[model samples]
Target: MNSFEHDVAVQATNDDAQTTKVNAVERGYYEDPFVRYFARKGSRKSPLINRGTWVRVQAVYDSVDRFLEIYRESSCRQIVSLGSGFDSLYFQLQKKSLFREGDRFLDVDYDSVISKKVEIIRTNHELRTALRADLTQLTNTCGARTDQYVLAGVDLRVVEDLKRVAEKVAGFSLEAPTLVICELVLIYMEPKHSDAVLNYLSSSFTELLLFNFEQVGPEDPFGKQMTKNIEARGSPLMGLSAYPSAQSQKERFQKLNFNKVAAISMLEYYSKCAESLQDNVKLRIRVFLVLELIRMVKLVQEMLIQLFPMVAQVCKRI
Candidate 1:
């Protein structure tokens, strides 16, 4: 697997670890037991990192949950997750009663990553039993198709590969109201490739809600350092230059032919959506002095706003 693909597993490990904490930001619905097995030593993340992860998770979850409310009245509804590496979102949605019996949830990633994930699911009795999938038939394949969940391996740079996987494995319909998620995935790819994917999605899906979560503000020192650090680890942020700010991100989708688009930075989300969850944060950092807590929150907000800011964009096809 490439460095970027490996990074997904690392993020999953961190999410699993955070879910096990006493006052986790969101209770992990399916906190996979195999996360610790794949995680490296010292994989435990700091509270700041965990909180950031939680914010992203919560934002996406809320968006999907909102969509499902309308999806119930629609004929066909599907969720397509790009570069979905060991994320338990499908399971989580099922637990939350958001995933219906006939709805399709497709998780696409590299062949190597999907193979490992399928093996993990096969060996884990809880995951296997929950999906009602046959463990014996899941081996030696880059893709696995269950009743509701479809895990496929495809190179995201190739638009044809995505179309083929969706048809053959996921049985995804273009006319269906679909939620397309590209979380921290496109920034790692070249701008042309990312653009091609976005253009394809806009043209292919009639009723679509596309959400992209990625780092913005690449002109700043913190963004430069974050880019350099990832490059040092052999995964460069190639698309950051194409959409370095929140406005640029919103415009990117507009130019791609999405009818409606809105982008919000992590700082704005914290100022708005996070108020409801502040009590959990307070409990987790209770040991800190009052001044320290205030200072830390401000520091985190400033860092998120100026430095490694994350932008969440919602784009809809008319």
Candidate 2:
């Protein structure tokens, strides 16, 4: 496929993710009040899909929560969401009054995606009131700045574009204490582009916590099939083979001068992080399905995880 068509497919992954999130919520996996507004109504998904979505949401959410609580005392902190699709975490967190005055939440994505989101905010009462975003100055390219929120239609491959947006948006800065979230974002780009982006963030931030979620493990039978499936769908995992393991992903951040870095898989995260009876009870069905999938597929020659939940890490920049 051509670049434009490939980009459209890449953008559709946002819908795929949102659909999964909506299904997860409908299935009682988590509480996300704003996802419904963006996700189109869809039929309930399998226990496996719901649980997989829950793992992604829970891991990233936990990392963001930890960062906010740890730096709650700091002033004018920022949360920057790269390739932020229809995610509503900022609005949800804002409802709970988690962000103090001067703190900003910025969501950056492609122009087409951001345009639709901007229109949704303009038309939706809850969204407009929650963010208090004034869209009077909305442009063709899709960008709006408010006291506590920023929506920018950006091409993330260009570091200068991000720098420009950061320069323009309050609390979004290279030197500021920033939590950079990139969920399923990096795998779309070439390694050189993504590496440059990471290096820029690493070198510039006075304090940074990067939460990167993407595909990993492409050497095994399951991984090989997973890679083929993704590529056949038109949007290939361009950067997957380069950083195909958790250790490789961890080292990618550590080499960027991060002081603290750790990467964990979905299976490992479930084993270590799920503490309560409720969580276990809720997830038991999905766990059974996961093992069943292993048995059924012969786990591509062995019972193993194909795609990852993501590298849940504290990737703190020194």
Query: Who wins the lDDT comparison?
Result: 2
Residues 1-318, candidate 2: write the lDDT tens digits.
788898899999889888889887876778888898898978867655666677778888887888889888888788888899989988888888888887878898998998888788888988888875565543444676666788888888888887777666434655557888988898898899888888877777778888887767788766787788889889999898888887888788778677777666666676676664376555764555565453333332232254454433333444
User: Candidate 2: where are CA atoms >4 Å away?
Assistant: 136-141, 277-318
lDDT of 2: 0.76
Over 4 Å off in model 1, which ranges? 1-41, 135-141, 277-295, 306-318
What TM-score, to 2 decimals, does candidate 2 have?
0.87
- In the range 76-151, model 1's lDDT, one tens digit per residue, is 7899998887766776676556777678999898887777777877777766666655633333336787767888
Error of 1 at 286 (Å): 6.2
- Cα-lDDT of candidate 1: 0.68
